[model samples]
Target: MVAPLSAWPWENFGRFKYLLYGPFLAKVVRSRFQEDGPEDSNWCLHILIICALRGLIHQLWSSYSNMLFLKRNRRIVHQGVDFKQIDMEWDWDNFIILQALIASIACYIFPFLENLPLWNTKGFIALLTLHMAVSEPLYYWMHRCFHGNHLFTHYHYLHHSSPVPQPFTAGNATLLEHLVLTGIIGIPILGASLMGYGSISMIYAYVLIFDFLRCLGHCNVEVVPYQIFETIPFLRYLIYTPTYHSLHHQDMRTNFCLFMPLFDSFWKTLNGKSWELHKKISSNLGKSARVPDFVFLAHVVDVSAALHAPFVFRSFAAMPFSTNLLLIPLWPGTLSVVLMMWAWSKTFVYSFYQLRGRLHQTWVVPRCGFQYFLPFASEGINKHIEQAILRADKLGVKVISLAALNKNEALNGGGTLFVNNHPNLKVRVVHGNTLTAAVILNDLPKDVEEVFLTGATSKLGRAIALYLCRRRVRVLMLTTSGERFQKVQKEAPMDCQSNLVQVTKHQAARNCKTWIVGKWITPRQQSWAPRGTHFHQFVVPPILPIRRDCIYSDLAAMRLPDDVQELGCCEYTMERGVVHACHAGGVVHLLEGWTHHEVGAIDVDRIDLVWDSALKHGIRPVSSTKAKTSQ
Candidate 1:
């Protein structure tokens, strides 16, 4: 019988996804904590880490080696390179690894490159001969073919454009060319050994030597002794010269052998070349990577975190207290109502989402409602909170803060969780500099609808409650804390929107099917929105609000959503590819709020029962409430 077929073959294929995000994430952690030590040490560490990683990965993937061999991500190079030679054009690292990625994956699906019988199982020498005869020739030939397709220049040009190649520059290629290269280079080895012309282990070694030498061939060294090469003609016969490889970058038509001078000799494309561009290429690369010794991942994290201050301010500002107002004169009595739900928070949340950087990464695009195997979000939940705000038809949600409400002269400690004589709800803003979350609560709203919650007295929670606590509106909180946080999944709170029949959050209330979230959060969360209902309850964000006076940066990854057909008068039209880090003199975009949530209220009179509900769930009410009863 023929050998067994693979059942769950691609299962381990997920390993490839790791490389896509692993380095950036590692870089983030390293940047935040570890300094890269000395330059020589840094190089040594990188080399060691790579070598160790390669060994472990190869072993771990050996059983599933067939799959890893085929994947686009499994690589011999430190990084990927895009095919574009124009240094200014490549937006990020993914473009660099394009070739190796394309090649690896194709081999997984179709092991075509070294497909010849009798070449496998004959042992090391036979395997070496077959690999040398086939894989090298194929790599050279296809490497040459990639140059001919002018329209295909996007893939090939990027490879040669690296006048100075870094370890990371190895993987770069246009996605398509990556696939082509993988097919030509990887398949033949697998196919040949399968036909029994040689042993797989020998072929493996040959492939390793070929790759290691090729990398060394692109040297940034000035110490190569041309005198020795001139002395040993047989050595010239044995090894590929540094100048020979660099010449390929200069002229695409010749010098294609990646291993020995086999293909070049057979095809009459060999030249006795020498290494001279070493210093120039190294200098160029050094100048180009001038982004402070930190890895690119560090830069991205810096940008994303740097963006948080504005996002936080904008999100906090869109509070009902500031955005909407229904001065009920500290009175009571209101009718069952219709809520005018306009999320004042649209811009801020969208801006935060856009600037969060993780969304702009390659992973978010496919998230148009699909379970993509994100490299970074493996175990973490979404970090950003999502919610909706409902404004009553005649009774809009008003807001204040804990610090503003309490007027606590308790600038020096010592205070109990006291319930005050506030009518509607108290929005408290913090002012003082005390420890235990410096927030105070007082002065309330009346006839408020029910109050919806993601969790408890997170200082800001009291401020939000005071803004929306109208008299009769009910308050229902899906407690997000401790054990409860684990129970309340990301979708749990978003699902609260459905629990809300006639309540809305947000003050600059525009009519929309959306909810605004307060600072309600949980333990398990990722940088992106979680894949749950508390998340689904949040509305799909409209594209970011771009305006003319504002300079739009990060446009390479920006575009209109797929659904919008009519190109209405958008204030900012992305006319060309965005050159990143372009200094914008002023505020870029007017952000509203990132995570919007629903708001409602239970009568403060019934708030005792609410306390009971909270206490029963082991959650103390956000702030103690003193209500006027029907006495």
Candidate 2:
């Protein structure tokens, strides 16, 4: 078993290339940049010109290689059914290089960039290095922020919408985010407020080189290979891994460093785990899917628009429109969250549903109320699942999903994300794979007095109603035109129909009692209810026989749930889960499954200390939601 996160999969071939091109690279760098100082500057004019052309040659080669590979590998090219998987990002990278150079010099260190008095050979080198040193970190931190809660999901989420990212999606973002996001790109001009023309040249060079490298790194085909340089400590930091950055977009957040590794190393946020996760997800998600030309071209148009956005953004000076105009969508009101969630589940990128391996699982953080979901999904839907979980948990409800969701998202350190971000969500299902809907029929907790069903007309949804009918549990389901839930009740047995909950509380008074226990009692000490749940565990072999790949697995005793349901949604293509709340409004007798998502990481004895303190100071679980009766 090899180290998944530690080993670079490309090391074999990359090292071969490195050894083959050894002294040649040394000569190229030394001859072009004049590492020997004054002698190099004397030939600076000739050196830079040749270097620029040589760079152009390499860029062309890299682009052609990637395109050729895409042609050969038609499957990955046709990835998304709607071409969403294809990235069409193409831009005037060369032109931008020229532009950034000027901006860098003019906007920052204008005095020094002016190359005025300190105009020595070493001084030129100093200015360039200084410019790079500052720009890199600034670009990184700003990029990191763009992935933050307030920005990434909406503003930045658009850019990462693609799973197998293309070069065109490199810098694709809305104009506002693009410009504000690139605030660090103009370090020299923006920071030092430079006035010199030379500084602008430096900025141009920096942007051009940076852009070129980023494109190469993102290219589907590997040119030169990274292993040769990566193992060598210093050079390793210069190149960003394609696998690394792609995962940043896929299951992003952990690795936000770009350009170089300085940001990752400094912040200690360098996610070595991504490369392994990428291979894990890429294999599971089927990297062989083909994409359409139009999809690829769309990326091109988007990049073109994004690049032009900077130029024409402020041109609309008609009435000095307030930035507040964009505020409505940014607020992320209920509808926005719902729409995002709906879109997420429909897309194929949600790696949760297709749980091929042990990649889906989560860790419970005590301070936070929810579980952390961090599975390696190419789609960005984990946030949605996290939110759904929190929404369910906050309401003290347990969700039984047959939605083919890789519930592993929560088991994969998924708890931290907002409800909508779980990548387990996809655009839709393959005809009969609506396993999440099956949860609608699960056995309700005798303790739960209410039930809600959201997508009731689907197959599994109707099944849930049938199951609930048999259990004598109260259940309600919501319906719309396409779902066809009423057909379910009509098809249900007369006995099942008798259990349907309608006009809810009106007929509810006859049968059940809603009670919130005012006191905590051990299972042996008190009868919260005469009927309680029975949990039975059937031990099974590890999902991944190989251990390295199993580190991401969520089956350790600590990783497994206190209680679990299997053979239920695992292979069943049921719609509406036994525990599913089908419609926007439905009723369900909720059951809480205390999975590892809720208590896996907790130290029982430690909880005892806190419980003792709470008991003494009147602070505890029942401290807040306690119910009292007139005794």
Candidate 3:
């Protein structure tokens, strides 16, 4: 059964809900244009600020809570946030928008509210007193009532749907629950106003404090120092800890207080183990987190994509990464973060998941994709990669795979520099390009006898050319350097050498229907291919589909095995449960328990073996139809 107030009227609008403030925004702009001085009341602007502030407060707590390195073991929930829960809570700030509109209407109806002073010390004191006297107990009882059989099933269950509670979970309630919450929240402010003790500062302070406590309680990681309760034992009754509220989520009948445990204590509903668990979690604050079995070393693509990092936005990170206009406002802050990372230049854990009972994590080198091209940044990038490898070796990690530009030949010689420098390393270092070549090769049709290959003398290109030629397919290897071309051509058998033909111009592949793009191509170059030519790409940023008749594929990727568990985040632009071929390659190495470091050149002989092993482990390729859409 659905409650009458279960959904918002503008819920379907999605991100367009920001348009709700258009009229109020126009009013402020008009006031500014008309040169309305301090005499003109800007109550609408004040309400907007308060609403924005509340939302920011929630975001700050969420960002801090998700920092895994800060307090790993203190986290109440170990599971990652999945796309389903992310979608459900994407509109977590809906309550703020609703209250903003309500406040605007109130100001219009009760004109006196528009003239409230900016600061009033007495009003602030009265707001706090009223919140304690009326709001707290009222909310405690209201919360208890909602947990009853009828309301729990219809109205409150949605709020508790997320098994792993987060900061936004505080506001991820149904419209019906917010209706009651809005009233519980409004009483203190309305009472203070009605009693001749209300001001703008009072409203701001009360709402901000309310949001702060709400987010504090739901943040899965416990931040309140346990010694605070030990120093003043009775203070525990006045304030609730994250663990206290987490207990209510675990055993819903207990610890029902809103922000203070006094109400729960009075009602005999406080969980007895709350204090004990809090102390236990606090003990782990200074300890080192557990080591991961596998680590995929990655780097940021750009400032826009950086916001899609798991710690930045759970909802955004859960989906495929893309640049959006809404992210423009955040660019300045993101740039600052980039600068800081460049100065520090160290590796940090970005995200993690469990696979077959083993912990796998993605650790990012503090460098962007473009930075690898910079002459000065290359040394720093390599240093960070080496540091991460050494750290993984020290921690006893089984395998660490280099991703994207981190394994670039120009930057680190396909991760050969570190392997040579540390030959005694126990942890296997893998560039994972062999699997990358296999994924691109396996995607081609069995009848692809003659193919045009771009970047033909490169690491993956060479492997691909050799693999195809051995199967009696003619490979047109495009390259500007004859020395590099001949070096690769000679690696093939004498009979297959005839299959590898060196070409220098786009016109050379004009008649080839099978195109394997290992390098970027121009619109004019793409036009050289005949109609119905399917371009199998391994290029970064992928190529544009200029020809309407021709098809273009995305970067190589494979869907993980069905037994892979808790895979809650999309890998870059890859769909859910899908990962770059390089990432899957590392997993295959760990599963096979390969001791040799798979660095430097990609071994052509093992290409088929790696592909078969991936399939044997249930890792499947992205369907051609599905791969096209990712582009």
Name the candidate that leads on lDDT.
3
lDDT of prediction 2:
0.35
RMSD of candidates 1 onward, in order: 23.3, 22.9, 2.7
Under the 3 Å rule for N, CA and C atoms, how many clashes does model 2 have? 117
Error of 2 at 22 (Å): 47
- Residue 389 deviation, candidate 1, in Å? 64
- Give the per-residue lDDT of model 3 (tens digit) for 98-183: 88888877776667788777787788788888878898899999999999998898889989998788889999988888988888
Better-scoring candidate (TM-score), 1 or 2 = 2
- In angstroms, what RMSD does candidate 2 have relative to the true structure? 22.9
lDDT of 1 by residue, 295-392 (tens): 00001111112211211222121221122223242112111110110111120111111221211111011011121124453212111101111111
Tens digits of per-residue lDDT for model 2, 280-399: 433444345322100000000111121111112211111122344443443444334334434544221111111111112111111111112224432344444444344434433333
Best of the two (1, 3) by lDDT = 3
User: What TM-score fits each model?
Assistant: 0.30, 0.31, 0.94
State the C-alpha lDDT per candidate: 0.31, 0.35, 0.87
> What's the alpha carbon RMSD for model 1?
23.3
Flag regions of model 3 displaced more than 4 Å. 30-41, 286-288, 624-631
The clash count of every prediction, one per candidate, is: 125, 117, 0
- Which candidate should be chosen as best, given TM-score against the real structure? 3
